[model samples]
Target: MGGKSSAPQVVLADDNSPTPSLPPSTSDDPTTSTASQQTTSTEPSAQLRPSDRTENLATDRTSNPSSSVQNENAAPVHTNQLQLPQGTQSSRRRRREASPANSREAQDRPSFDSLGPQGETTDEPLPKRRRRDHMMRLEGDNSNTNGGPRPFTNGSAADNLTSKSLNGLSKAVPAVNGSETINGHAKKTDAESSAYFGHDREEVSRLLIQALSDLGYSSSADALVQESGYDLESPTVAAFRNAVLQGEWADAELLLFGDRDGSEDEGTGKNNGQGLVLAEGAQKNDMRFWLRQQKFLELLEARDTGRALMVLRTELTPVYQNVHKLHFLSSLIMCPSTEELMIKAEWDGAHGQSRHILLSELSKCLSPSLMVPEHRLAVLLDQVKQSRIANCLYHNTEVSSSLYSDHRCDRENFPLEVAAELHQHTSEIWFIAFSHDGTRLVSCGAEGTALIWDMQTLQVIHTLSHTLPEHTQGVCFASWSPDDSMLITCSMDRYARLWDTETGQILRQLSRFEEPVSSCAWAPDGQSFVTGCLYKERNLCQWNLNGEMVYDWGRPHRIQAIALSNDGSLLVATDTENHLHVYNFTTRELEYEMDFKVRLTSVSFTKDSNYILISKIDGEIRLFSIENRKSIRTFAGQKPGKFVIRSVFGGADESFVISGSDDGYVFIWHKENGSIVEKLEGHRPGCCNSVSWNPKNPRMFATAGDDQRVRIWCNQTASAPVLHRRHRSTLSGPGPV
Candidate 1:
């Protein structure tokens, strides 16, 4: 369906006609003269005009009236009012050719060519235009002049800028200050601030989950495991743990060994459910013995003496080779009642309930990856809290939560308050020492009595005194041998005696020295010991286990304190003349000697034997590198003088130094930096003669003082504000000048 359209009409103007003549221009300017002559001829110029279609297109583009027009043969024109494509001439060229010299438009017109390529007639300078286009690309604006997409150089530039700004703002903000402040409120430099806090989230979560499950908070632990996405506990192990908790001994054993068959006899070793098939040879034997032993204990608790005897004779007796453990179990069989059995076995509870503790202990035999620890989260948290208390310097409160983790503890758990204030000693207790096993504690006092305490009961088990045919004067120091079977005590009467810990009898008496033995230390090997005298002769002597003197070194000044290294390779001794000497004990040669202005009260070597710690009368404790012969660090705050204030390295890695002060306070300092961690207050207003950290229990330590009481310091339950007592003497005197 097409309709014929009429042909468009076209009109043409004559181009060869004579132009009208005009008067000559009077202007002297060549530009004006040339323009006037061109207009006077009255003939049409050769310059081309836009076609009617182009004029119509320009008119229709009224919204963007300044847009450049495209011509067929010439470059696109650019003007102050319109932007054009690159390689185009300015619109000034068209205006100058179209207007007469004598007209007002001609007088105002400018020639762009004469002004060079950087002409004022252009929309913008070439450099500025290029910069604007570049910024647009960075902003992700890809549209071009022709309404087409253009490629971008950096699409993420804006995002990068935003991130940098946010980072700068976060760093500019100051950290909070006050009680909630951490890291000791110490200002950190840029380098320190940039350090990464290398915390493993998965490992922490796993430990927390294990801790929670062990503490009987199964629901909480389950919830945590679900939220943390950490599947640390296996269903098999969970079933085994549940069986143990429910007192299903046989079922628990089957789960541990992955043996579901329960066809084995109860007491015969012929079939014991294959006994943890995955366990190694030695470990499997140990596990089988432990499991059978536990079964025997359960039978005895149930009053099935017949079955218990069968288990002891056939199952347990054949595999359980530990003589002491076998004897203990055999003795349990003779208990007249469950109460007697519980008492003899040291059970925490009665009968069935007590079996839980046994089962818990046996659980330790399993690999940690296979079973949750028998200890509760609360207990493990208590240990962590206690460790922080022991390691922290300047800790003022009676109890504190761990600064590194969420573990918390009270005094009852570790014993911040005196659990048992020993009044057995008639005079001030001079020294207190815990046996290596932590089962017994020995305290010597000015009353010439040495009391041995049962740590479990906190009761005096034995009262060793001059009445026992030992020393005539008060005992000055006491130390337990490495084996914890024997004890050595030195007295003001100039004798050092070795005593049998179990029988509370004197084994042997050391030969009398010219002066009182002020200090004594047991060698790590347990076969030898060292002693320092207080006055005349000033002898440092090494004695054998039988109390026979083996080696002796004479000194001009009285020995104030002495220590034997853990390996027994080095001996450190401080004298009254403020001199510290280190000796290679095996070679019997002096390694180094250091002199101080103030008298050195005590000296001890680090566990590694690389450094020596010296306590001075000037209220200072100094750490010196043995090889470098230079002071590594200095600790202050405790008022030391007029008494031998022994400072000891303690904590998990010997990371802290604990010492007693004359102001009746116990001070703990960080060994590396010498920062005061905690200042404990429990003793009465006098000197805390000595402080001893329990070798077996890092959380438990004892401080004896002039208060005539041995105060057991542990983690207190209450977070009571520690009463910080300022020693006026410490402030008034010059410390180490």
Candidate 2:
């Protein structure tokens, strides 16, 4: 609004016309000769070059009102006044061929300096009546007569002129500084023409868009021009500009190769990064332009129009508009055609921007039929931002640990969603165990392999498999010795093997097991271990480090879960019969019995042994006061009638418990009241079988399911997970820890 150049204007004119005429030419056609010689003067016509004389004749004839009318009437179609419709190749070609004679005539003329009434001067030949008409129309003016001024308001004409002239110039010549010369000659070094018609970033974008859209790379071009300020000189600006207007970014990319040049490789990345290099010394402030171009390039690579527009508004538009352009951008982003992942990534990445500011704007623009994930993410993002303490915790009682909290969970109270998950199992992980220091984790799966993972990096350090082919059917469970130096893996082959974790070598194998062992645990002193069988009558058995079974709590119902106290004096077990039995390791006597409302699938005790977390068949997790053998709290919000809780683990602090459900979610609950503290999503297509929190960091955890992938998540913010490792853990390392 502040710049006069930005405004468009047209002057009202009368019917009167008094422009001068030129002398006739000598060598051209009758009409050309007549038009060219109108500028003849007493000043030595002999001293002038032929081309110079011809240029003078053409300009002078165009300047003559009567000659201008004659010329316009004589020509079959005035190329100067032509406008080509978009995508009409035949019409544009016709216009190009039609103007050759006029262009040749203008080329022959010598440069002349003449002043118009309003301090406007031209060294090159001025446009004839038809050319003037074309220019007027290009500037959005069409009612003017031959050689007469048209009336229009300020701002309108200037703005239109600025936008369209740059747009036109870009279409005509895409090369840097290509249009700087006019009429076959360069203007004087100090001429104001250069400054008046100079191309800026907006102009460049406009040109880029025009070229891209014309060639069918409309999508890429659209991304380029959107939200960019009115700079036309930036090399790729116009291509990008036309793209945004047309919503044809993909087409813009195709345009560079002549509009779907090849039929076979359509929409492939083969032609990506085409012609992006700028020549040396192209422009002084090219870095800024390059960065702007780079942004569009990224959009092209990402194929994300919304993100590109967001970048343009937040970073590029402010340079011209002085105000943030995000309001306009949000509308474009909320368009239905955009992908949900791209939109969520944008909002998640822009957390520093106020949620109210971002969401309110989005709500106004977004449709009611928005994709479910985007809607959920938007709502969750807003809720998280509004809350004050949004920490998420997952507890693992086995190692007395909790995963890291979500860094972005800034809420008034803890959010009921787990922002992170960690899963690193290659095969069917039957058991998982955290090392003594909680710095490492070990897991055994059906592949007969044991993996050691560095808890801090969440990466696999070692993979162990028995060298002897005699062993088969795969390992079911693993437990790390209290000293953290040894790992024991139990397999369905009725064998328990001790391994040196540092070297991944088998140290000893105990083959005394009777049936397929489903679960195992290591005593705190590392002197003995326990194993439970899948059969209903195999009895929970305790074994010494040397491989001798000592306490065989004879066949009860199928033993499903087993655990030992820190002191090794108490061993607890649960069976398929929904009963819990406590055995005194020192006395070798069954001392206690307890019953639950439902068949308990699993059981985990808190680090202090004061509480236990039990997962039931009906999608419920019950926390119990272990010492008193009474139910403390129940966590029961599994999706109605369809999903059930699979497993539960008591965490380090005794304040949190982690549970896996059939609804593809891993939930963390406050152990004291069973209030859900967090819900971890991302496995929307698969049912989760198990979940475990990292002992070292309460905020990191793992989830495995029918998706055939294990995902490790590190909670970063309530808006989104910080790190999402999918399938990577399974391909590389430790089973599930």
Candidate 3:
């Protein structure tokens, strides 16, 4: 229907309507009306309005005499029925008449579809009780037709509306209540979680205690132990430590040995008679000796020379069986003043400030399994932190700070800028050498100048030049004597001269060569040295301290580089013929020879004298084993032969090979694995020709470049910080080759 039907139907009574009379019982029974018939319509029914259609269906049922009995028993139809306006009825009638069977079904059923538009229905059956109850709810009248609510004749609009309202109310009510309940539950959960963690407080306390001890915070550790009800040291150990700290040497010894007589065992006959027996063990003997030695030093510090000699003879002499120990103790008597004694012993200060250190050393003699060390936990944790820092591949820091829970090695600090620059060289520096004592450094350059630097001050203490007849052209190479008192420099001027480092005076001059001296090295024995000549005469000459040539090998190829073994028994040399030759100086014969195929720029020996480091012009550095005569490893990341780039072993236990790059960078590679570890970029505009690691300090190194600058790299967080002036100026020039 175009609009809802206004016509009324005879069905259930409204309050204002009169009650309908019941029909008399019939002989024939009516079949149950199928809900499916509601949607089917006849042509005559569609031509009329909804009220007219309802009346037509009822009249058709009553007129048929065969169905009259069934019609009388059927329930009365509701006024609510599918209604169509007059305009749509004609078109609908044409479609309905086309389907006669559907029209007949519509005439047979009551019109419950009057409630709303007839929606499509599925073939599935609905449960009797659920359907009946649901229909009763939608009817708005609770009165039952036959003992219970009537079953729905067809799916109704009221049923869908009631179901949706019920569902929406059910969802909305719980959602509001659930939010409030969840918030209250969360508060209770947090309270319970806090209580649970309270039980772990003791473990947290223990960890804090451990951290304090490891960091050498003794005062803090003691206070924490008292507050936390924990004991880290036994009473005897505490007493002994206190005694050592207070410089009560005799009391410390008594505590160590459990003896009342401090001197009776040594036959001095002095005793306190407290009846304490001395602990007897080999370790106790060493502890007793250490105590007596410390006491002797105290006497020396007090200028009680006569009593110190007595203690040395009566107590220390019997215990100090090692010759070195005896000599060290005996030398203390010769010191005329306490200041000199402190200096000689390398003590930190006077007045027994280092007594605790002495005690720490003495405790090491005792068996660790039976005795707790003074700072055992602290030392172990410190070691772990250091080891982690040394091996860290990333996130490394210069200092161990609170930023990292575990110590980190900050890689950014590396390839670090120079802490100090040696500026005396007026031209490009060619080579650098450090003395065996690590107290001095010598550098030679193309400016015909050779300068000696005091390692402590970073200042030039001496300079050797052409004015002294050492070189007429630029000095190209330099080496230090093993004793550190004499230095030798070779120049393009064709002569190699030795100079006294103290006076900067020429000690001796070797006979002038036909060609320039290219390279030189001092033998480990300090008796002789070797020089390699360039161009004119391809000879490797060995000379003694008297400026006399002891041995000379004239090879067919030009000698480029040479190195002497630590024992001075073997010499390894590289030549222009692409061959590496090893000779025994004692036997005066070539021990071995190997062909490299490429030009060799430099050669060096490992500290153990078992392997050789060979730098080649092919942009590679190879480690060759002397025993196996085979290549062990190859390090890359640096292009060789832009200048004579020298590479050497460094880092912990010589685990890294460090070299200068032609690209203005210093490259470090793991010696064992040959992996690039660092590419330090500080040298600018030209190649870094040489790098030298300080023999005394593993973390400090120096690099020189064609820029006429000598840069010193030091770890700022190291124990002994280096002194330097920051230079922001750049030098522009070509460096020496």
Best of the candidates, TM-score: 3
Candidate 1 positional error at 641, Å = 3.3
* Candidate 1 accuracy as lDDT: 0.58
What is the number of residue pairs that collide in model 2? 102
Per model, how many backbone clashes are there?
Answer: 18, 102, 10
What digit string (tens of lDDT, one per residue) describes model 2 on residues 1-737?
24444322212111112222322222222333222232211111112333443454455444423323222112222223211111101100000011133333433432221223343434433332232223323221122221213222110111111111222332222111112222111222343223335543323344555566556786776566443322222223234334333435343332222222222323332211121122222221222322343444346335588677766766555433423333444444444443553364353222233233333332232122110112343354457633312233333222311224433322223333333344444455544556657687676666677778765455678888743576667676677787888887777776678788888877877665567666778888788788888665545877786778777778656777777777677778888777888778778798788887567777776776666677777787777776787887888776522432345453444446776666666677766555776676635545666665666555455555545455555534421423233223443432332
Better of 2 and 3 by lDDT: 3
Q: Scored by Cα lDDT, where does model 3 land?
A: 0.59
* TM-score on alpha carbons, each prediction: 0.44, 0.40, 0.44
Model 3 poorest ten-residue lDDT run: 88-97
The per-model lDDT (C-alpha) reads 0.58, 0.47, 0.59
Model 3 regions more than 4 Å off: 1-415, 467-472, 535-538, 718-721, 724-737
* Model 2, residue 46: C-alpha shift (Å): 99
Please report the TM-score between candidate 1 and the true structure. Answer: 0.44
- Local error of candidate 2 at residue 131 (angstroms): 99
lDDT of 1 by residue, 534-639 (tens): 7747378888977777887765668878888887888888888888888888987888787898888777778788888888887798898888889999989986
Q: Rank the candidates by lDDT, best first.
A: 3, 1, 2
RMSD of 1: 29.6
